[model samples]
Target: MKKTLIAYFTRTGITKKLAENTAKQTGADLFAIEPVKEYSSSYLICVGQAKLENLQNARPAMKAKPQNLQDYDTIVVMFPIWWFTCPNIILT
Candidate 1:
């Protein structure tokens, strides 16, 4: 059987939920994009961290990167939009 990959990042789970739906429909393997350093779930802290990173032009490193990228012909990337932008810097 062929396999597919669906990688996603969600701070508040909205995008996570959507990714799940896509996976369900497509029978794809889902992987969460997590940072090397976990952060508090608090909205205040999330905002602060985002701002700090943006100010420093720093991208929080991810805990893991996609391995065996060629194994899956279909790769679906799902993430949330913050400040009217998708933070591409978080891609690892």
Candidate 2:
């Protein structure tokens, strides 16, 4: 099996659990994609923030990144659906 990395972003822990299961099944390293400035924990506030960020085309800074991306032959990216697309941190 090729070396694999499972990177994921989670707002409500849903994606996080899925990523963990995938990582375990595939024997891949796990990496959490976090924002430098975390969004609100409240669902309503988070939704509002996402909308504003989307309108502005904002790419929030990521708190962590893979140190040796070249070492992994396969990379799996996972995230929650936000505004019918991905959150801006994944684009960064």
Candidate 3:
């Protein structure tokens, strides 16, 4: 059987919940793509930061990453849309 991985970045808990459900159904390993510097809890503040990052074409640093990515035959990435695209951290 091919090994699968579900990697996700979530600001609110919504995307995390979806990733967890998908992982359960697919029997895949879960990896949280966290940023080294967390965004502000306030939605407005976060939006501002995300907008700036987008304008700068930034790739925020991650706190952790999956090892041996070659081991997984399939990898699913999930994240909420920020500035009409995935958050900058997802690029890390």
Candidate 4:
């Protein structure tokens, strides 16, 4: 059987919940894509930061990446939409 991985990035925990539930139902390994520098908890500040990053086409540093990522035959990425797309941190 092919191994499956569920990788996700979440700001408000909503995407995390969905990722966890999906992983549970699909029997997939879960990986959280975290940034090296955490974003502000303030929604407005975070949105502003996201907007700036998007405008600059920035790729923020990540805390870690899944080990043996190539071993998984299927990888599902989950994240909340930021400026009409995935967050910049996910690009790291």
Candidate 5:
């Protein structure tokens, strides 16, 4: 049989919930993209890093990008508008 996978990265969990529901509905395999350096739960850190005037907004690094990208024909990307753009890591 053909295969389908739901691949996503969610920091605040809103997209995670949506991915779960979509996977259940479609009977697709689910994959969560997580950074090696997880962010702190404190809202202050989020706002601080997301600061528009500060260059710190773009310096945070992800441990690695998901491998096996060629395995899936379809991929779902989720973002939360970090600096009016998708998370910097997604571009990697």
Candidate 6:
């Protein structure tokens, strides 16, 4: 079987659960891309922050990263769609 890595960034746990389930079914390594500084839990605050981050083209620091990326033959990235695009943290 080809080695696979499932990397994802989640803000409200929805994408996280989907990534987890996909990883389980595909037998792939799972990695969650977390930011060094978390955004506010409030939906409105998060939306505001997203807008600010987009305006600034901010690439927030990721708390964790996958190891041995070269080992994976296939990679799957998952994240929630914000403003019709992936979150800034995912771009980091």
TM-scores of the models, in the order given: 0.83, 0.94, 0.95, 0.94, 0.69, 0.95
Off by over 4 Å in 4: none
Instruction: Give the per-residue lDDT of model 5 (tens digit) for 5-90.
Output: 77677788998999899989978778776766665577788666556324543544556555676777777766566667776546
lDDT of each: 0.80, 0.90, 0.92, 0.91, 0.68, 0.92
Q: What tens digits encode model 6's per-residue C-alpha lDDT throughout 18-85?
A: 99999999899899999998988999999999899999999999887789999999999999999899
For candidate 3, report its TM-score. 0.95
Question: Per-residue alpha-carbon lDDT of model 3 for 5-74, expressed as tens digits?
Answer: 9999888889999999999998999999999999999999998998999889899999987999999999
Candidate 3 regions with alpha-carbon error over 4 angstroms? none
Model 3 per-residue lDDT at 47? 89
TM-score of 6: 0.95
Tell how far residue 36 is off in model 4, in angstroms.
Answer: 0.7
Tell me how candidate 5 scores on lDDT.
0.68
Off by over 4 Å in 2: none
Q: Which consecutive 10 residues in model 5 have the weakest lDDT in total?
A: 52-61
Per-residue lDDT of 1-92 in model 1, one digit per residue for the tens?
68899999987789899999999998999988988776559979877877777788777788888898889988888888767765534544
TM-score, candidate number 2: 0.94
List CA RMSD, all candidates.
Answer: 1.9, 1.0, 0.8, 0.9, 3.0, 0.9
Tens digit of lDDT per residue, candidate 2, span 33-61?
99999989999999888888888989998
As a whole number from 0 to 100, the lDDT of residue 54 in candidate 3 is 87
Query: Which pairs of residues have clashing backbones in candidate 5?
Result: none
